[model samples]
Target: MGESLSQRLQHPRRSLGDRHRSQAEKFLRLSNQGEGEFSVNIQWAEQNARQALLHDFTHPENWRMLAKIKVLLADDIGIRALLSDLFAVLGRDPEYVSQLEDVSLLDVGSELLNAALQNDHLDSDIWIQSFDASDVDSFVERFLKLDLSDPRCNVLFGRRLERLWDIAGSDVCIHLGKVLLSHRPQNYEMWTNLGRAHERMGDYDQAWLCYDQAQSYAGHLTVRDDFKERMESHFDGNSSVAWSRPEISVRKDFLVTMEKLSTRFSDSVIDTGASNEEVHVDQSGDERRLENMLKNGDFSSAFFLSRRLVTSGEMWAKEYLEASKLALEGKDDVIIP
Candidate 1:
């Protein structure tokens, strides 16, 4: 019985190898541009590669385990997996807004973009520079997912396209422009997009580097004044150059008064988890001593105080901004929960 079982239990290791090669050839044939089966090739490649997985691919939770196995066999194969997936994706819009949480798309895209840049393949796409296409304008206006917001996607996309800050899409150019004004805020080209991104973000100070830097580059008096005037109008226009969050000043004032009122009515405003008594904050700064007066609840004082804080914030926007930033950095108690 043992001898019979051994003959019946023969493993097809060599047969599997032959099958793998055949599948690989089929994958190449199916990847033709005209045939439009690249996505199919990708899927087949992934399946074939997974057949070589150390763990049972049939198990539901073994994808991560399979990846670990792939990485062991070859780091480049893992990278190819990333690029293949990116090329197959990143370009096409997915109906589902969800992303692969197991593989952070941002990190994956950044790695792929760096590889592309190292290979000197940055300027392959030119749609990044054309500001004239009315037909291909951003019809994808409404953001279905918060993560897929233009600002966030632009950053991830730009990083992936090498210096694509400038191409495959206008939104990319606009986003990279904004990234320029953050820490590396000196890259003139980035600042240009930063200006556009700021416009989209609703910040007027988000002027393009060309407008801002034109002053230095001006060789003639008339040209310098023309550029400067244009820059001024650009900032003064609908550019949404928010220094921070919306209603930021009011938010600050609301927070400050909240702490003061919280101390005044310590029993009510504290969120001890056990207590259910509620509180509110008003940033409008239009309330008075009567408004601050609380009764069976601290909510009134909290609301009025918050209102005063926010309203008062507008009067001292810049000052409040500095103080708010310092508080953020120093962990000041003036900060409201």
Candidate 2:
């Protein structure tokens, strides 16, 4: 059986993309030569083009080829959707969005794709091909400059980082994964990838935490349980000692570390507009701040703050923690102040 769409997305093969794109180009040329049935030849071209995209979505050429096919079919809506998907992969740069606002894609789809290719700043595959992976510092410096808020870009970069785990090491994955997750904590696949990186590095406790987060967002997933089973199997024939989750204090310390790492890349600054003196004078300052964070849909920050407060023996923060967890779980009834 062929790989599922999720599997292809999670583990893209560039060689497959190249092969399929070559076939697509061949079929497209044949279709344009007026040799066989035009519709059948074009449909074959479209199928191969689609496969190319599925194999390597980070490739601008693959997107452009598909967009061209869509235009040939006079699929205006498909062209718009394709452009939207391409914009998502590019991190939705404001320049592209603004330029496309009043433009007709049907009239100039190819031109727009050319413009996007020239302006793309978030193509992880391009970065991977252009940058030296062995130079971790340089690579990370370039990576940090990109807008990591888009989950699609994060996932693409995360997959690339996973491929470079041996050279770049798991720490880079953990650091950048935390940074990206701070912006879009709902990315369960990224959480799973981060967990795999940690597990590969023998950081079982941190892996458990990441897998736990993944399961939290996608309860039907068995990543956490699978991790536990793997741990158990690792110790099966070796010794009587069995693996267990880290102690509460240890887990809390891990969360603290993640919280600190996330803050380094987080763009959201909680501006209370209150002076230090006013904050010191107000007894409910932290509570108000927590409420504001929740109201702003900044659940990542809210979770960390509420957890810290609750750990410090502030009982009021317990409610906030509950509310933050509910909100994170996407409960509709959880209302923010």
User: Best lDDT goes to which candidate?
Assistant: 2
Best by TM-score: 2
| Candidate 2 lDDT over residue span 156-211, tens digit each | 66666655566676667677777767655656788898888788889999899889
Give a tens-digit lDDT track for model 1, residues 1-337.
2211111111113355445545644554565443656666655655654553211211212233234323433454354454443232233233221344355533353444344334322222433343234523342221111122112132233333334433335454553333222211112233344445555554433332233432221222143344346556755756776133234443343334334533432234432122222333333332333133333233323333433344444343333433322322221111100
**What pairs collide in candidate 2?**
none
Q: What does the lDDT read for residue 311 in candidate 2?
A: 54
For every candidate in turn, the CA RMSD to the true structure comes to 21.0, 8.4
Question: lDDT of candidate 1 vs native?
Answer: 0.35
State TM-scores per candidate: 0.24, 0.58
In candidate 1, stretches whose alpha carbon ends up further than 4 angstroms from where it belongs are 1-139, 142-152, 156-315, 319-337
